[model samples]
Target: MILCFALGIANMFHLHWIILFSVVCLICAFIILFIEIPLLLRVCPTSPAFDGFIRRFETNYMRAAIYFAMSAIQWISIAAKRTSLIAAAVMLLIASLFYALAGVRGQGFVGSKTLGGQGVAQMIV
Candidate 1:
C-alpha cells in the first residue's frame, strides 16, 4: 500500500533477483501476520489486567515487526549502498517511533518501568 509506494520511490532499477527477494519477503510477512491472528485471539486471561496488557503488547510488537520488514524491503531496492543504508536507518527510526508509541499506550514491555519512567519501549532491532 503506502509502504510499497514509499519503497518503490527508492527502487532505481528492476533487478529480477531483488524484486524476487522482495516478493518473497512480503509473502512471508503476510504468512506471519495470518498465523499470529489466531494465536492472538486465543490468549487466555488469568488476570484481567495482565491479559489485557499482554494482548496489547503483542499487537504492537507484531505491527513494529511488519513495518520494519517492509522498510527492509525498500532498503534492498536502493542502488547506492550508502544512501540505502541511510534510508534503512531512517526507516528503523520511524519503526521505533511507532513501536514506542504503541508500547507505551499498551503499558507493557518497558512501559513506565524501563527507559527512566518515560513509558517508551524501544524496538529490539
Candidate 2:
C-alpha cells in the first residue's frame, strides 16, 4: 500500500525513473509468484521448514502483485482522466491490504513447524 501511494505521488511529478522501478517491481512479483513458489514446493516436498517458508513467501509476493496491479490501474486512470477509477483503485488496494494482513497474522499464530516431531522423520523417509 505504501509503495502504491508512493508511486502515485511520484507519478504526479511525471518521473521517468519511477516508471522503470514500478515495472521492475511488478515483474519481480510475478516471477516470485509463478516461478519461485512452485520450484520451492517441488524441491522440498517433505520438509516442514521449507513448507512454512514457502507459505509466507507466497503470501507476501501475492500481496505485492496485487498492490502493483492496483497501482498500475490507478496510474492508467490518472493518465486517461478517469478520477472515479482512481478512487476505485485506492479502495481495492486498501481491501487487499487488509485481506493479506489477515492471512499473515493467521499464519503467524499457526506456527511454521506444523508437522512437529514427525517432520524430521518424514524428511528422512
Best by TM-score: 1
Total backbone clashes of candidate 1, pairs 3 or more residues apart or in separate chains: 0
Computed on alpha carbons, the lDDT of every model, listed in order, comes to 0.46, 0.48
Tens digits of per-residue lDDT, candidate 1, 1-125, equal 33333443443344544554445434534433333342322333245563453345345666576557655655554543333333543555496577768777885544232222232223221
Query: For every model shown, what is its TM-score relative to the native structure?
Result: 0.36, 0.31
Over 43-79, each residue of candidate 2 has an lDDT whose tens digit, in order, gives: 4444666455445644544654555565565556555
Candidate 2 local lDDT, residue 41 = 55
Candidate 2 global TM-score: 0.31
lDDT of 2 at 120: 40
